[model samples]
Target: MNNKRRIDQTEIAEVSKIDTYKSIIESLLFVTGEPLSIREIGTIIRCNERETLEIVKEMEKDYKNRSRGIKLISSNKMLQLVTKPNNSEYVQRLLKTNVRQSLSQAALETLSIIAYKQPITRVAIDEIRGVKSDRAIYTLLEKSIIKECGRLEVPGRPILYSTTEEFIKYFGLDSMESIPSLEDILNNFGEMSKNLKSE
Candidate 1:
């Protein structure tokens, strides 16, 4: 009986520790207002990355099941808390502006190209699009949807651009692998063109 009692106590302590960790994670995410890498979170919570990822995954499931207004989003092993997309309208209304404005056709095209062919140079993007993408690239950079990833190791050494974490969150993707296949995106391009023309 005493052994059973000790076992129960141990289990209770473990559960309490997990709960504490969850609470700490919630506070960290809320305060940071930015994505935190799993390793960073693990360091703070005093757990290994694998264990931290498991806890975060559990929290994500719980938040979804609870139908919470805020949800956890992750990409590139980084996690952040964000309002549900369905609640964007209310958020925008409160902000008195389109906080999540739709991208222009040019910007969308440029973003798509960068997302799929990341670390690509501007000249390469221009070659693919058959037009200079300076304006579109500028807009994407301003919006933080894309960023300078590096400079190509060529004679000219032009800067390379890649999609950012904000891009993943904007597209409601968990990771780069979550992006639709190139063929799928190509299939949808026709519809996108039609919608853009209509606008």
Candidate 2:
């Protein structure tokens, strides 16, 4: 009976520890309003990354199942708390400002290309679109949707571009893996174009 009592007490302690960690995580996310890497979170909580990830995943599932006003989102191993997308209208009304403006078709195409083939160069982007993408790239950069990641090693060493965290948030994606397959996108585009041509 004493051994069983000790076991129950141990279990209770473990549960209390997890609850404390969850509360700390909530506070950190709420205060920062920025994505926190799992490693960073673990460091703050004095836990290993693997354990932190499991706890965070549990929190994510709970938030999703509860349909809370705020939800947690992750991308590139970084986690952030954000207002639920469905509540955007109310948020915008409260702020008296539009959340975001629509992008141009050219900008959309450029963004798609960059999102799928990131760390890509301007020349490669132009080649794929069969047109100069300077304006579209500029627009994306200005909007903080994409940024120069690095420079290619080849001659002329053109700059490489990659989608930003803002890009992921704007698209309501949890991660880059959330992006639909390129083949699927191309197939859908092909069908649309075929229908347009037929009409």
Candidate 3:
């Protein structure tokens, strides 16, 4: 008699390659609820951006046909697999929780000033607001709503901060051109600068 080896064909008996891959996909999803850049996702997954992006796209297809509650969404240069908003009420009702944060009225005002006048310096923001915006700028940077666009070609060569891609998406704007008219700006503006100068 000859002895033969048997494979454990049970579905859940052993972890499969597909399962490992899905685990990676699931983990990538947990890193952020917002759409993440391919480079960022790759760094987390320990893979090249192209490979990670392909896997994500495939995972998105699988998610669509399955009963899984999460859906992978790609927008611009980012990818996000999030719980469908339609399920938000049920999820919230069951969890009895909400997770959200927003800028203060002052921070909002300061950011608006920068949005209209970037690539602009902090001093200019202070000039328009008539107050120091160090803290507000710090907050905006921390939130990734604004970033250092470049350094101004002036005496101090102050670092210029401009709105980030997140800023546009958060405001539901396609681009800066849609930021509203000067009249709209005037109406919404809280302060103005007397020595208005641009570099």
Candidate 4:
């Protein structure tokens, strides 16, 4: 008798119900909302780089055969999920790109600082970077990146600046908790103030 142990149907059913590879791929696909790279997908799913490539190959073929509403798109290192090209126009109308006004780098930076340290004041922001951020703050206020959170207890009762829901949406964050932490910001932010001073 062969000694190979058979994986039970229940186990198979559970795994099938929550297929690690497929689920991870779908999750990554959803996050990207466009073509994603194999490397990026693997990094997001915490999977082996080569294994992620294999998974995407299978996923792409499966979607093609089944004709699902969402399909896998593999372009360069960017693997994103998109509606079939035939249906892109309809989807585009439904989700038109917001072309009202875009923000500049200074505006985005001012917004980020307020976001990470909400209920902060202009003075505090200036202290951090050792420069006046009045223009940047005004720009952010105009863009609704920041709003008056509340009044502080000091003599001047300076208006505290905090990020708005629109700020979260603009930055693709689900909520405040979803925004990266201060430490994460330090790690990821690339010379935010240094560039600001140069400009």
Better model by lDDT: candidate 1 vs candidate 2: 2
Clashes of 1: 0
RMSD of each: 14.0, 15.2, 11.7, 18.0
- Candidate 3 residue lDDT tens string, 22-123: 577677667644445677767866778777767777777788875677787665446566676678888888777652246776679889988888889999
Query: In model 2, where is the ten-residue run with the lowest total lDDT?
Result: 73-82
Candidate 4, 7: how far from true, in Å? Answer: 99
**TM-score sort, best first:** 2, 1, 3, 4
Which 10 consecutive positions of candidate 3 have the poorest summed lDDT? 1-10
Instruction: Rate residue 65 of model 1 by lDDT.
Output: 64
Worst 10 residues of 1 by lDDT: 134-143
**Leading candidate by lDDT:** 2
* Tens digit per residue, CA lDDT, model 2, 1-199: 9999999999999988988998999999999655677899999999998999888888887788655899987665677777877999999999787766578888899999999899899999999999988767866775699999999999999999999999999889999899999799889999999999999
Q: Over all chains combined, what TM-score does candidate 1 have?
A: 0.53
> What TM-score does each of the candidates earn?
0.53, 0.54, 0.44, 0.43
- Candidate 1's residue-wise lDDT over 1-199, tens digit each? 9999999999999878877888899999999665677899999888999999888887887788656899887766877787887899899999998676678888899998898888899999999999978767765775689999889998989999999999999888999899889898777998899999999
lDDT of 4 by residue, 1-199 (tens): 2333345656777557436778777876686443455776677778778877777777777789655876775644446665666776677677696532467666667776777777899999888767767757765665567788789999999889988887878778788889667887775566786777799
Error of 1 at 3 (Å): 1.9
